[model samples]
Target: MGSEFAEKVILITGGGHGIGAAAARCFAEAGARVALADVDRQAGDRLSEELIAHHRQALFVEADVSEGRDCKLAVERVLDTFGCIDILFNNAGITRRANVVETTEKEWDAVIDTNLKSVFLMCKYVVPVMASNGGGVIINTASGWGLVGGKEAVSYCASKGGVVLLTKAMALDHGKDNIRVNCICPGDTRTRMLVEEARQLDLSTDDLIEEGIYRPLGRVGEPGEVAASVMYLASSLASFVTGTALVVDGGGLAGSA
Candidate 1:
């Protein structure tokens, strides 16, 4: 496992923080050259520097992933730096916690475009490169809510649900090309995104995370935990695995109602 990705290159969206950042560190530790793309330039640059300081190969690209042009440029920049991308993690995402009635058009578009469309945009550019290069891995970040509905997040639920099917469709289409596509359905994890979700609901991060305490594991997840799942999906261990949503929520959805 340590040497499995020694010379491979990984391009990660949302790689500035949270699960993306955590996964970047894990891959770097495994000897992969990592390219992080994020709209948050400061956070992205900081993480890249941190990884370099630790003797890891890392690059940061400022990108608004929801747009096609930016996604193309991001892929181009990564290829320019790393030569090839063996894995593409479409992990950039956002959430708007609101029911249909409360979710504005802007909010709905933001959630859908970020959570779902970004996956398609990135794949549109990277898939051809992977195909020409022989093969590659794609790990998308869908949520447990994508499998089950959330109380006040209609748009988020809808977008993630789209991701689930989109992942499958891509897997079917790309399997012949030897390009594996899968998505992770993680339960509540401790990350900046969780903090933003808490803010949307007017609850403290601890209070929000407490909602996940009833899961069998009885705790919110750490970003590294979810990142571990990402590693598995990207690794050869899942060579025969594609189109599946590997849930990493510590049983968060085992008892979903």
Candidate 2:
């Protein structure tokens, strides 16, 4: 599957680090021109330079995807640089580990806007462009919690659950336009975000890993593992796959099923 993405243009939000950054490298290695839309200028610029060093086309757009203006401008910048967006990876998201009572209105809004609304905002702008251009692939980064409820994470669960359905709804609404929409439900991966989640739970990274050892794989996942799944969905291999939530959670939800 190496070079299957030759000449494709993929726009990734939250592209500065973790799964987004990993996917950027994967796509670049596969010969895709990648545009990173992220709020972290330093990380984005650094990653872009790395890709360019490897002779890959890469652009970093500083953006807060929760805002419509930023999303629109980011897409425009990608089009201006690459001329087209063959794929859109909505990976920008945040989590607040709190129940409804513990979650303040501001916290809930922040989680919802960043996790759920950003998908809507980016797609709102990119979908029409894809439709007019004859079709494109869109991959959203939802969580395993999106497929099932989790304790002490009401807003996050709600936001990701929304993404799970939103992806399906978009696929149904835009299939005629040839736009494919899907989401990935990842479990506790070893990202900075995962480490941060450990901190939020007042535990060390090791503790977090230990807590997730019950997965059928007996371990958490890696960013590249999840990125591989995204690549599959964006490739011709999954041309017949749409409105699906492909779980890449190391069998974390297998037993629950």
Q: How well does candidate 2 match the true structure in TM-score terms?
A: 0.97
Model 1 deviation from native, Cα RMSD in Å: 1.2
Q: What would the per-residue lDDT of candidate 1 be over residues 86-176, giving only the tens digit for each residue?
A: 9999999898988889999999999999999999999999999999999999999999998999899999999999999999999999999
Inter-residue clash pairs, candidate 2: none
Cα displacement (Å) at residue 143, model 2: 1.0
Instruction: Please list the C-alpha lDDT of all candidates, in the order they appear.
Output: 0.93, 0.94
RMSD of each: 1.2, 1.3
Please give the lDDT score at residue 6 for candidate 2.
Answer: 93
Show the lowest summed lDDT stretch of 10 residues, model 1.
Answer: 204-213
* Deviation from native of the Cα of residue 222 in model 1, angstroms: 0.5
lDDT leader: 2
